[model samples]
Target: MKKNIYYFDNSATTWPKPECVLNNLKYFLNEIGGSPGRSGHRMSIAASRLIEETRETVGKFFNYDDTSRIIFTKNITESLNICIFSLLKAGDHVITTNSEHNSVMRPLRFLEKKGLKITIVKCNRFGELDIHDIKNSIVKNTKMVILTHASNVIGTILPIEEIANLTFKKNIPFVIDCAQTAGSVPIGINLGKYKNCIIAFTGHKAMLGPTGTGGLCIGKDVSLKPLVFGGTGSKSDEDTQPNFLPDSLESGTMNVLGLAALKASVNYLLKMGVDKIREHEKNLITRFIEEASKIKRIELYGTKEAEKQASLISFNLKNLSPSAAGLILDKKYSIMCRIGLHCNPNAHKVIGTFPNGTIRFSFSYFNNLKQIDYAIEKIKEISRIE
Candidate 1:
């Protein structure tokens, strides 16, 4: 809401989305107001075309070609829940990492209480996970493996390809929560090689799209039961839910307005290139870490190496709570950042910042080195406080 501040909280949800996203959303409201797949009228057909085109764009962005397998949801959390709950049941074993957000952890924990077995592969304090740990944790009953593509708290990118390979060999379904990496990092690079992987992504974080827009780029090998069932505009004669792609998983009416903006946002990403965006944000991370590390009292978390992480950095000043520093950065310096566990307490525990979490500064493609310099100066002043 406050556009005047230096926004560095892109990991939670990207702010100041691309101008095209806003423009297309306006166009959808003004020009195309119809429910996709629910009607055969001109406006409905136009809206359906937008959704399909956006699906194709998302599939291309991930290097995944099967657009039908991509099922839309409100967010990555819902996507992850559908994968976790639908794929696993009692007596089944699931594997995950310590760097996962609660989206993946909560569902697994709930299933664990219902007679499901869970193996939490531990990551190092740097939030780096070893693929060997995942391999060794697998058993005959291991049904699914769910984890985050990157740490929401420390911005550490996990060894996704390696883990996906392991799961493919084990014939286990691998569900990836890509809430932090969807538009900022290139995903599904190995989807062709790994058939058992499902990538759940949110549109708000790095995709430059509005909230309430996300979905699963499901692999051919994975078949999930519908998490929600309702009118899919098909098979109307029968009360039974349709057993197919997209429609089967999508019950309610599609978010045509949000998808119109998402279509524009992802097209913009494709044009700008995710790799280019990654490099730009990497520069910002490198600049901020280089200067923030100079303050002796500041305790930086994660691998500090810009290449090994996403565009976020977490730190704590000696004798200063993260909340206090966050307030000073917000009220005094007009810098917007996230503080506390960042919805991933396990990550904070892995990085030894549990309970009282660290201050997080997440960057985006729009961020620059000059903004990093200003944030560092403010952090330096804040660290000197008693």
Candidate 2:
């Protein structure tokens, strides 16, 4: 970790994860460093227990009673690919928003080239999309409605609850990409919302866990064909993949250490409360918007209203490239930010900054108002150049 760096790029990945989370990682490495669901050894059983406990807690987090259906994966991208490739056929169509991370867009684009029809609904210049636009985009052959809960670039929170209702009413399956809002905000979807929807999330970003940890909260009604077929710990005699939840998606050795850390992080979030975490980030964004708005050369993107956003802000300086601004913030101001399209070309196009991307500052639970104020001062000082 950089000693004096102010991390404002948490939307890409969080920093200074809770001590409990780190302790859990240490616990895994020290106490139980064995593969989950593989052997009958005590360490292996302990690993399995950790994974199960995390799944149950996550189920409770989303208000899902059945934890068995919670499938683990490498991250949101792998989870989305599992659902997309498993469900969508060659002639099927998928409807999604204009502001999607490459995690969703990349798989959809690859599937599109492989003969899957896709219709991307456009959001406004502020990265706001209307539910009616979704209704307008739906066609007879549409199979899935993939949604990004919040824009990674602009932090605009979408109307997912309404969209979930629409998908249920139309008997369409929905997949929400929760990469930007998972642990930082209050979202109790997956099993609580529409039964036909699947929620994909990563642990490293908002969940505050290590990388190589993430999964999909698969709903009761959705049955996905396994993308990776290999040996499951259960029914080792059978050559085919087992028809179970984690076993179905998880083929190779499980990341018990990572899941142990994730369990600790999720527990910490449960203790602090998602609402409180959300409020903290909102305060940071509010101060960020309030202070940065005074800079004459800076044009901020996303919803001007801080209450309607996640924990991120996107903006551009007049005449100064986003790369240059980010470099200056890093080298000169000791600040960090994400610069470029942010893996969402469609979002940039919608926000009218396509090829040249905006500088994105994503917030996390650990960020404070003082950091926000400092970042704002740095931006203003940088923009005052002759």
Candidate 3:
């Protein structure tokens, strides 16, 4: 409705968190401004309680059997590092997809140079990875399999359950980077079913929380060595990190404020129901894709249909570069989107738009059909330009 500003970049980071989120952050800053699990005071205890509540809410979201398995990290990137660098050793083989963000790919590549073997399965131009491809990639020495839950640029949702089943049978520790799909899509992963799994989630994206809020859900089979060893309020006497679910992984002072905000966001989502949120986002996708399809010169990426795609879309103009499209959207159309590689060069490569990449328009429950309408109108104009 505003003159020149519509935020359509929820896939990268969601905007306008719920009122509860803001209130919780404000409360944390005002009242519970203490280092959680560190200081032995009422303020610290309150902070710790907020953090635990967030973990419990997130654990239920993923159907985790134990809330304690949820370990806080700065973001999914940090969670990936904790899972990757902690679990994999010198001669281990790891399976992944081409549709991964550099967060996962970068660490894996670094380990690859350190003599860890890596097998990269290529998704099709639409960013669809095959379960058979993953099954074939499993080697005897394979220790872990890491892949992104959804393609950040293209919004292609992977069949984690199918792949998870295969890996579960093979007894491989599966680490999933749920940067785009967590809290946005249905994650009915029964942690009991998968013997080995670690799902890394960020609160800044579809979770609709503030930045610097994220964590990793350590599954049954993945016994990760601690990434950073430090003092936990629970085990202050021990020189080493505590041999527990969260206290082992979490080090230093925790992000109490961010966690408090995330707790409110997660509580709001749970109350609203994930199914309803998915429905809202899916509706936006359907309308947006239909309108974009009618526009000439609009080169859509990922799965062709809206139903096949997640709540995001990536595309480019016939004669415009991604950055140019982004600029036009910002200055003229008032739409905010991500351009260029979208932090996943391999995802861009999979879509045959490597190097330059495409403009990514991802949405969440906050976005409405009317906003999608405005976006469609502006996109039609931009796509037609020479």
Candidate 4:
């Protein structure tokens, strides 16, 4: 008999995507094959229409009125890089949290070398940020404030709405990396109230879409220079890049097939409702925490409360390295999860798990209580041997 693989790495990328997404991926490839916004042919027009429909769907999902403000990228990393590279200039100060993923860290580090001042506001060991510390870090020349919506390593959900409000009042552009919280948590997209905010999202993770589907929702007041310049299907009469919302930023052949998959996935979420998804994941987290807390020698990280976190947990055995434990879970128990720094060494350092990271079990809505029980039992068994 084939071993049943129990996947618990939804924070990295969700597995077993919605049937609609898979069907559309095939439909786009087989029936509606064409490059979006590249030509005026029938196939191209169909592709363009599909892209626009997806944009509208995304805009509605985020509660943003302007559909054109939604710009697609390969992933949240690319979306963040575009915002970081376009907004900051020489001698500008930017504020961020220490718990940020490398997607936010690497680009800021690259900019810091070129006369950009960076302030890393410290989060608690639980990965919770203090809003006052963020406010205190802001200065006269603060160009932007970029932060992650949730810690991908420890699953702590940061207070991004409060941060966005603060940055809006300060006239500083707030860029939120929502790779971990987009489809799992509620992202306030009140563009009228918070005009200087951008929410960057990846579709593959909680959105239940394929890879290469991600984008940013830009506010009206924020202006960003194009990171890439090429054909935008519009304003072809001039060689200059079009000075518009999405056309100015998106300048290449788009991933129409992937977007079709994303559209279907987002539609599924919309129909099912994000609130329901959040409730289900919270129940799973609650169960995992309750069960794992009973086992001796199992050390868990972050705020031990499920309400204060996303749907994930990070922990370590008393004597086992995260790598070794991950191997045991995979080979011996047929369990799958993420290990190591989770691309955020800074998060590990903050959580006091640096050098050797913790094993992360990130759950999705599809995961059931039985899986959590089995995982806890296996973890208990591992803890006993080690």
Could you list the CA RMSD of all candidates, in the order they appear?
1.1, 1.3, 1.6, 1.4
TM-score of 1: 0.98
Q: Flag clash pairs in model 1.
A: none
Separate clash counts for every candidate: 0, 0, 0, 0
- What's the CA error at residue 23 for candidate 3, in Å? 0.4
What does candidate 1's lDDT look like per residue over 1-386, in tens digits? 55668999998888889999999999999899989998999998988988999999988888888889988999989999999989999999999988888888899999999999999999899888888889889999999988888888888898788888888988899998888888997774467778899999999989999999999998889898999999999999999999999889999898889989998999999999998999999889989888988998999998999999988889999968999989989999999999999888888888888899999999999888888999999888888887
State every prediction's TM-score relative to the real structure. Answer: 0.98, 0.97, 0.96, 0.98
What tens-digit string does per-residue lDDT give for candidate 3 at 145-241? 8898888888888889888888888888888888888888877677877858778899898889989989888887878878888777776766866
Q: Encode model 4's per-residue lDDT on 1-386: one tens digit a residue.
A: 23487999999999878899989999999888988888789999899999999999998889887988999999999999999999997899999999899999999999899999999999999988889999998899999999998889888999888998889889999999999998998886587679899989999999999999999999888998888999888898999999988899899888899999999999999999999999999999999999999989989999989998998999998978999999999999989999999999999998889989999999998899999999999999999883
Q: What lDDT is obtained when candidate 1 is compared to the true structure? A: 0.89
- For model 1, the stretches where C-alpha displacement exceeds 4 angstroms are 1-3
Ranking by TM-score: 1, 4, 2, 3
| Candidate 2 stretches greater than 4 Å from native | 190-193
Candidate 3 clash figure, as a count: 0
Local lDDT at 365 for model 3? 88
- Whole-model lDDT, model 2: 0.86
**Error at 277, model 1, angstroms:** 0.7
RMSD to the native, candidate 3? 1.6
